[model samples]
Target: MPGCNNNSRLSAEEVQELKQICRYVRKMIINTVADAGCGHTGGSLSEVEILVGLYFRIMNIDPHNPSWQERDRFVLSKGHASPGYYSVLANRGYFYEGKLADFNAIDSMLQGHPCMVKTPGVDMSTGSLGQGLSAGIGMCLGRDKRGLDFKVYVLMGDGELQEGQIWEAAMYAGFHKLSGLIGIVDYNKVQLAGTVVETLDLEPLADKWKAFGWKVLECDGHDIGEVVDTIQKAKRMSESGPVVVIAKTIKGKGVSFMEGKFQWHAKAPSESERKLALEEIDSCVE
Candidate 1:
């Protein structure tokens, strides 16, 4: 986390600013996804607070020096959530915010999935479900072997837990006691096809992680304060092993009609619908 103020907590003003960033990022996601004509919308919208909490508040890193050796690494295992990821990186000054609308354009730097080689701030290229955690574990191990100090955070989708590779990586991290690796599951419960319960129930999910020998934390994913605080706790938690925070979220948060609806998972908004979604988001400002 080179050149970052590694503060353990946010002051009142900082918290308010972080909340504002989350709201703005939500609008950016709508605009970016709408401009793309088609993109993942529901999960992107749902993950707003968690990403904002990390980028704007918790993680330490220099946007200007994205390749800094000490920079914290992030892997979006649930890579379909690119709309949200791109919006954050753009707004954080990793690249031109205007160009975000060019997402998925042929040969554009911003494409359907994150590309570490193409994107300035992208730590790892990821889109394949269930693979990012394994990559993150390797990063943690790399840091240890190189005697470098930095954390690796992996954000995953709840439905992604069904991937065997995820468990395999979890088991490896647990056995090796990679304390610098943190896994965050966006437990929104809804996927492109249906609810997680109807699709693949991950009941006793936290316990499963515990069984894997990782520390477990759960919080309201949409609550900026809670998300930030929980992450800070994970950072300071005893170095017993890797930590996983199961963040409970809503698939389509903020947009009224789209909230919790699977149909909006990859649905692009019509011009009118985009405007309406923006207006709805504006009304929720507190």
Candidate 2:
């Protein structure tokens, strides 16, 4: 609400506007991690546009009433990326901007991973790799049972797809035709240990989802316009089936040294590195 307007489709001007906001989110993410001295960097950076696209321009959410029943829900299955998550929420006015300074500190509400009980905008407390999609399925099914129509959006790391539970949930969602649920894979291709190909290949990824009965979509995760269009198309498919947007992204997207580097998966930038990263982000907007 603070940065972007809600829309199913965006004009060229709106897309550029969202891109600038996304760059800001990326800057905020690294700064938050640097201030805390520990946080996921690469994955958080890669998914900034995806998160910003959803929170700023797509989802029907209220910053003032985070518990509003009609509000769409979002689950960051890759929960270690709390720096990005917290920064986006703060920027969206769900909480005070100053709280990000306390991230990961002693007894801080903003933990290393998301805790729904403690965090104002977090819908589900998540950290375990393969559980978030299953939880999203449960949310969708429960909403259906209650006769509610709010959608549930879930973001997962490509590495996390190796978990069998994800496929299980996929199968279940497909069978039930839970079209109100949308899944986003941050297919940055690089994960904690190494490349996703070396770690666990999700290639033929869209085909796999198709086999599971999902209406598969793809996009450049960092491209705000394409991402928004894909989400809008997915939302328009309630009569079809569950949708999974395989968003291909570069890990550590905006910053030069960090981009595509697996070592930055969970490493915070040092003081000098932080300064350099911020400069890179600043130049992107300029």
Candidate 3:
């Protein structure tokens, strides 16, 4: 959506474009799950702005050359959010939009989880949760070893943080000063079962990252401008150590009926529900 000036600074028009893309991407996520009859609905919807903000404005990526060595790398640690990830990748021209209909099918490149071998733009195979950060840390370290310059971004679910491995990876990143690594927590608070706090609390979350030796930042994940600005801030300050942005987001962001509802976590909409969902997205003010 943003101009290819290749930096995070957003013009008014670019901000508007990113917002429009968010709406488009959200609708795509809804339709994708509705078509498939099953998918991670709520989290996918929740992550539209975060993914779009990175893909459209923040990261230096090339959809045409998905594996270009010089391109930036992005890892979707919370792989159940593949609907959002695939929607953005398809819309960004990593693959055909029509292919989204085949999502999660046995032979489709778009799978329930990201597979770097199957998906053109996916940088890592993720879905096990709490492991993406570890892979991302390796990627960042690899860049140093190869004398290459590129940033690694890992998107993890807030609930996924409950996995002990996440903290272990955080500790490694901090101890090694992996400044090129950027960690994004989709802090929607709602998980598959219940609210994150009600399940396993992550209060004092920012402090946890700071204590791990990271420069922690927080933002409204639904706001594209804030997402871009905060990510750019992370990049600018990353030399201090790795950075983590705890993005506060709504569980089901763009759709009124699904917003903040944990039951919608992995449910597809009925035909009537799909109609209502698309209408709701269309009704949004661009």
Given candidate 2, what's the lDDT at residue 177?
86
Please provide TM-scores, in order, for all candidate models, with all chains considered together. 0.97, 0.96, 0.97
Model 3, runs deviating above 4 Å: 1-5
Superposition TM-score, candidate 3 onto the true structure: 0.97
lDDT tens digits by residue: candidate 1, 130-163: 9999999989888889999888889999989999
Ranking, lDDT, top scorer first? 3, 1, 2
Clashes of each: 1, 0, 0
lDDT of 2: 0.88
The CA lDDT of each predicted structure is: 0.89, 0.88, 0.90
Candidate 1 least-lDDT 10 residues:
1-10
Candidate 1: residue 64 Cα off by (Å):
0.7
Per-residue lDDT tens digits for candidate 2, residues 1-286, read: 2323355578878878888888888888888889988899999898888898899888888888888777889999999888889888998889998898899987888988999989899999998999999999888878878888788999999999999999999999998888789999999999888999997788899999999999988998888888888887786774467999999999999898999999999999999999999988988853
Between which residue pairs do clashes occur in model 1? Answer: 1-70
What tens digits encode model 3's per-residue C-alpha lDDT throughout 161-252?
A: 99999999999989888878899999999998999999999999999998988889999998888899998888778866899999999999
